[model samples]
Target: MPDLPDISNIPYLPSPARDMNWRDLNRFKSSDRGSDFYKTCLDYSQVLWRQRLPARAILCLDRAWGADLTGDEPILESWPLPYQALVYILQNAPTGVFLGNPRIHFQHYADRLGEPRLEQRKWRSWACWALSCKARPDFQSDPDHDVEEPSLEKIAQKLDQYGHIEETKLWKSILQAID
Candidate 1:
């Protein structure tokens, strides 16, 4: 492919989705390209979010989450950057930015999370593990997966309980909730 377009002036770009060639983004997929691809997508997503184009930002984030060389296990258990970005977006973006119910949105992504592993197990392990806490009683259930936990609601509640907390502290609380 041609050299990556100068993304420095993302604000001035017209037709960002096309300018970024989001549809063909997966063409860059390769084992060696995973981290860089994810980081680039994350950076663009953040820029789009700050540009008041949250819907587009979400598309970028979703693509980042689907980076071809990255496995869901690494995304769930090892990748801190994606987790941090996801937490930040979930905390800051308005629910209206999501096309449907936010829970359903998460659940949808969670459902699609590890197709390779999906057929091996009757129940989803990683994403469902992350989401099946009591706080989200609405999620799909797994008999072996129920854990008393801090759900996304718990994270949001903590954020609300302590108004204007430091960014690091906020990230800590969110991680704690998900962990």
Candidate 2:
């Protein structure tokens, strides 16, 4: 048999399905929700891993958790709760979305998303991890700019690249909800 492609590196799978208990769901609903936001943040982190966006995926995860070490305000402030959760998990997340320069990644997320209160140690740790990933001179930056501000067209394009008919339909549904 032909050598199988390494499947281990793929990230961001199992798209998010809006299925959480009322309590878990309510956390993102309130402004003073506290750690609940972090929980939701982690959940989205898992989703990014399944989706295969990896680096950008982790950026989404981190943005959700409120790390935003970077200075970008509009991306952070304008982020909806779901998107924020997605970004937060993306930040410190391992397993998928590996990127270089955790500090730069954190700063990039901050630049994309407005700054928020974050645990200093956790944020720094993630930054370190990101930097380690960046140390590899061979790592090329992601070509997809739309990952930051994903539009229907971008979603459709990505779906066409990696998704099946059902997945494409599901992405359309997600786009409708976001719109």
Candidate 3:
């Protein structure tokens, strides 16, 4: 059998927070408990694109989105800034963009977390489409277009479908990513 490529070999940029001005880092550190801190983290995550960091960018973006959904703070600012930041990162990342084929990454993480097959399949599909769309030209030009606006009905349905399981956390994070 051919040996599978090691996922760990993928290169990621170091966290920009390490190199940021102490004031900025202090803001992030202080805001960590605030809802807006996650969005700030997302903003910092944008630095990865300019620095050619892919894996780390996605990981941080995911973390930021996770914090956003946990009622960290209302995304008070318009989506354009964060969206553009993400687009820029996706475009420049060394992994050829699209965050490493969302289907594969999502499934790999899901399996590692011991998620059920059905839930894993659902998330994989959702994540793949979300990540793939990030590479579209329209995504960059029209920051709002790629976002999958979740209606109350959709959110409620998701809550109903996966809320009881630990996967709910993952689903919530996915919803944030899609937003």
Candidate 4:
């Protein structure tokens, strides 16, 4: 988190409005990699990501995709690719690069959220993959959905099925470290 400019020093406590700019966030000077403001924002994001339920998290994705993070187009747009990659890869759909924005098929995705398990993240990952898969040209969308709970079995099935093609490539990269 970078240093937050001293707004407290201002004479008037209230202002009608303040224009926010992202350039401030991008500004990096020398070793000023982690500013108070930047670290705060990342901490906020991490908290939000961690505490969020699967359903709510997906909904947040929807709102952000529909509109920039929280409103007027950001001066510096946020990249959702990392978020998307985390979601799809966890579900073993590493090739979901073709999955476009999930807005157009929101209902379809919201429906396929499967069941919840004690291990909550599993269903969220699967739901994320379903959304990603729906966008690919070949992976046809299916509305017949179920709320089946996710378990170790479910996770293994998804990995075995969807991860097959990428596993060899993934293992090759992993093996590189040994040599």
Tell me, by TM-score, which candidate is best: 1
C-alpha lDDT of candidate 3 relative to the true structure = 0.42
TM-score of 1: 0.44
Could you tell me every candidate's TM-score relative to the true structure?
A: 0.44, 0.34, 0.42, 0.26
lDDT of 3 by residue, 14-65 (tens): 2334444224424554235345555455545545544445655665554443
**Local accuracy of candidate 1 as per-residue lDDT tens digits, 1-179:** 54433323232112334334454456564553465576567656756765555556656766554554423324323343344455444445543444223334444454455543232111222222343332334444444433443454554444344322242254444456753
Query: Superposing all C-alpha atoms, what RMSD in Å does each candidate have to the true structure?
Result: 11.4, 17.5, 12.7, 17.7
Candidate 1 residues lying further than 4 Å off, grouped into runs, are: 1-27, 30-33, 68-79, 94-100, 113-173, 177-179
Sorted by TM-score (best first), the order is: 1, 3, 2, 4
Which model scores highest in lDDT? 1
Task: Show where candidate 2 strays beyond 4 Å.
Answer: 1-30, 64-104, 107-115, 118-130, 133-179
Candidate 3 vs candidate 4, TM-score winner: 3
| lDDT of model 3 at position 16 | 35
Q: Best to worst by lDDT, what's the order? A: 1, 3, 2, 4
List model 4 lDDT by residue over 1-179, tens digit each: 55433212111111213322335334544234322333323332333333322233334343222221221223213332123422432233213123333432443444443432212233234434443443333544444544543443454455345432333233233223221
Q: Local distance difference test, per candidate?
A: 0.44, 0.40, 0.42, 0.33
